[model samples]
Target: MRVAITGSTGRLGRALMAAFGDAPFTGPSGPVGWDRAAFDLDDAARTADALLDRDRPEVVVHAAAWTDVDGCARDGELARRRNGDATGALARACAKRGVDLIVISTNEVFDGTRRDGRGYAPDDPAGPANAYGASKLEGECQATAAYDAADATGRLAIVRTAWLFGPGAPDFPHKIVRAGEKALRAGSSLWAVGDEWGTPTYTHDLAEALVWLVGEDAVVAPGERVAIHHIVGGGLASRADWARDVLGRVGLDVTVDEVPGSTWSRASTPPAWAVLAPTPLPGREPLRPWPEAMADYALSLRRSRTASNSTTRA
Candidate 1:
């Protein structure tokens, strides 16, 4: 299929590119990496015409957005344009072209008000407390609306994920690991927020699942014309606990000091708990646990550094 992915250089976008590159997606033109330079998404009509005129992709994965939580809180209008308005425009463009649309969203759509701590289901009500979450929720609404306006045969899937970590992106888990290593070297304790809890998703796994959803009939038989799935890691952890785990995996003897989430006062309010419950598909294996994925990720980073060091020495 002719796949087009926005935010092609982003954390999840890079993974999507890698995963789809490995998959058997036959097209007159391969996957189009549509970055910000391609078109101004803020202008819906112009964006649609320009993108369609350039690359008529069969599948469009909308992943670009203003993900900076604090930044979004500071500038609500920019956040709305990038995350909300842009997505709606993209969805409309895809619908008009009869292209399958897969919109990558976040777990922040919830207000962090879950008492059960079991995580938010796809069908649960969304009440965003911050601009970031609010904009994403709006984007979701717009995507659904655009899909509804399209012909009944087209597909639109909204995949909500959380706490994503991968090779290329500057994710929280990797940052924690780096900080722990530094603290270990300095014989100091690393401080992390204990109050906030969320699921840690591996971008590699998430990307593969996205590809499966788009094409692999063996993995998921299409049950809904427009589907919503919660795609996240199998396990949940507090920020401090997750940091401590990363430290342990990296063979660091440093202590991780647990602090309140409120201690790191920022422009936006964080969710106390925003873990996303992964939806099970028909023939796919369960996603690996967060701990397992983290361990592997840590080891890979180490290996990469070692290789780089060897090359430098030579």
Candidate 2:
């Protein structure tokens, strides 16, 4: 099928491109990799025309969004425009052309008010604590409305994930490794928030699942046309856990000081525990544990640095 992906240069987007490259798919002009330069999602008409009239893709995986949590909190209007308005525009465009849309969303939609120690399910009511979450919630609403307006034949799947990390782009996991290394070098202890908890998702696995969802056999059965799936790594972990694991994997001898979330101040307040429960698909397998994923990421970073060093020396 003709597939298109926005945010082609991003962490998840790059992994999606790699995953689709290994699969059986095609795009309008080579692989449908549209970076920010190719299409500005803010321009609704232009974006629609480019995807519908020009490319005419069978599936459009909407992965682009303003992911900077602090920045989103700083400017609510920009967040709404990029994450909320742009998503609505894409959904409408996709609906007009009968193109399937798979939107990548976050787990920050929840306020973490539950003390049950269980992860958030897809059907749970969302109560955003920050502007970023609010904008993403708006995006979800717009996508759902578009699907409903188009008669809801399961043409849309909202995949909500959390704490994504991979090789293509720097993320929280990488930051942990970097911080640990710096602390080790300086003979200092790294402070990590112990109260915050979430499932860390690997982008490569997420990309694979997204491609599977777009396939012919992955359709939602009759009755429900719009589906919401929570695809995250198995098990839950806090920031301190992540830091210790990252340090261990990197062979760092640094001390990780577990601290409260309040110790770190930012423009936006994140959910203390917003882990996402994996979708209960009949035959779907759960993703690998966060520690295993982190190990792989650490190794990959080492290889990347080695290659860079070799190039510099040569």
Per-candidate RMSD, Å: 2.6, 2.3
Clashing pairs in 2: none
What tens-digit string does per-residue lDDT give for candidate 2 at 1-314?
77888898899989998887777755334358878876686785577667567777788888888898999999999998889989988898787777888899999888877789889998899999999999999999998898889843338888999989897667776677678767876889999999999999999888888777765446454456678899998888998988788777766788989999999779999999879989976666788887777777788867765675588789
Residue clash pairs of candidate 1? none
lDDT by residue for model 1 (13-52), tens: 8888888877786443457887767656567557766886
- Candidate 2 regions exceeding 4 Å error are 25-30, 151-154, 305-314
Q: How much does candidate 2 score in TM-score?
A: 0.93
> Weakest 10 consecutive residues, lDDT, candidate 2?
22-31
N/CA/C clash count, model 1: 0
